[model samples]
Target: MEQGEFALSDREFNRVKARVYKEAGIALSEAKRTLVVSRLGKLIRTLRLNSFDDYLDHLERQGTPADAQDFINALTTNLTRFWREDHHFTHLETYVGQLMQRRPRGENGRPKLRIWSAGCSTGQEPYTIALHLLAAFPELKRWDFRILATDIDTNVVAKAASGTYPETELSGLSPQQMALFERAGGGQVRIPAAARELIAFKPLNLMNNPWPMRGPFDAVFCRNVAIYFDKPTQGELFARLGALIVPDGFLYIGHSENLGAGGGNFKLVGKTIYQARAQQKARDAA
Candidate 1:
């Protein structure tokens, strides 16, 4: 186990994959061997372990909750940019307009709007949603509106909560958006408190049952997250998501992912967007 070269054998890779799947429900493929090796290499060096095997053993024996958290954080990929898929924002605007029209005003004379950004790595997606909500419906600023941004990785969740980023991270934003939503200084930019206040970032594991929040959200953005899950896992996860959204509520997935043949609870409305069929019917009946 030299500084430059760390060996992760097939046996080690398979073991790690099984552990990841059990803990996080993310199915790592054989192709991810290089990624696993590269990600864990630093942990090995930092612990001064002799090899990947030693690191694994250390994890097994002395692995507290914090150690487990670190392992998952290392293996999970958190690649994202602001408004990564622009079309979703357009659809969100339309959906928000319709929702506001239908939204009940009797709840203390202010309607509630809830959006969930599942697997919100580093917070960009939720922040993007917040900015869009403010831009599309400035009236919402006076109403009760909130976004829940969750990730299994505690590290990313903390970063997301910070609402601060280096200038390089602002590349995905347009000049107008950049001017409107962020305050730039000291070679860095931070989202204004108004936008940051709209989101709550927390750690969540999709595989865990009895989720804490009471949902029926207006929209859910779970993009690029289920790509790592196997088919059965994807089906179950989407079904749960469908349950959490209001009827006619929107579910926005990644450009490359889809709700396959078994997504019976929802109907395709736009590119990579699914509307809950039951929720829509319920809304109509009410």
Candidate 2:
């Protein structure tokens, strides 16, 4: 395993990434060749493989399940930032505040709310959501709620579950956010108790056979996940997501995507954001 050589050619890279999209609906666009090269090609060289074709063949013949995971991991777009989409977190902060203030009391006096950060790369999105929640409800220390965070990349997911981030990822945070979710050491930041407790990361593949998890989520964050899928697949995936989101729950997509061709089960609430269909609200109301 060398350190700087890449066995995968552009054509081979596209072929493998194409299979990823075909298998999982995660589009690996042309613009990301450099990313693949930078992220996975290093791994190819490290594996001491001289050709991408040989790498594939070795993976097919001698690669373990974990090795297969590494293969897929190399193909994913893990280019995430803290507060990557500021609006979603702002929207979450606003909505959750409203939800808490408007929360109906059960016999026991508690605010019950649930949020999911689907396709939560590494862990930034869910942790960001947690920061917002904690900031908005300083008393959330007393509440029983959690953020369900999941992604298909085992390595990143594992890293996220550990709640550690490199220094660069913390650059986008406000000083307040920095204090709340980080330790100020040289060149590193560690996630704090608040953000760490609020999110639970697991391995998830959006396009896998029969989704890996089920949800009746009050809010589900599926941002930037459907950009690669074709119309039919997108539609089906959203329809499936619709089934999981609480009738009155919220659905958030990437700023660039539209659920228009997918389905109208959600009505626009914000730019690229939608609330579950009215019928769902009606049922919840009843």
Model 1, stretches more than 4 Å misplaced? 279-286
Q: Residue-wise lDDT of candidate 2 within 1-286, one digit each (tens)?
A: 3466564577787777766676567667678777766766766777888777777777778988877778778777776778887887788777777777777764557666678887888888888888777877887767667789988888888888987777878775788777776665777788778768777788988777687666668899888877767778788888788878876678888988888665667889888778889695576457
Per TM-score, the best of the predicted structures is 1
**Per-model C-alpha lDDT, please?**
0.87, 0.77
lDDT of 2 at 30: 74
TM-score of each: 0.93, 0.84
Alpha carbon deviation, residue 103, candidate 2 (Å): 3.5
C-alpha lDDT of candidate 1 relative to the true structure: 0.87
Summed backbone clashes in each candidate are 3, 2
Can you write out model 1's per-residue Cα lDDT over 4-96, one digit (the tens) per residue? 868888888878888899999999988888888888888888778877778788888987788788889999999999888899999899889
Model 2: clashing residue pairs? 1-46, 1-48
Worst 10 residues of 1 by lDDT: 277-286
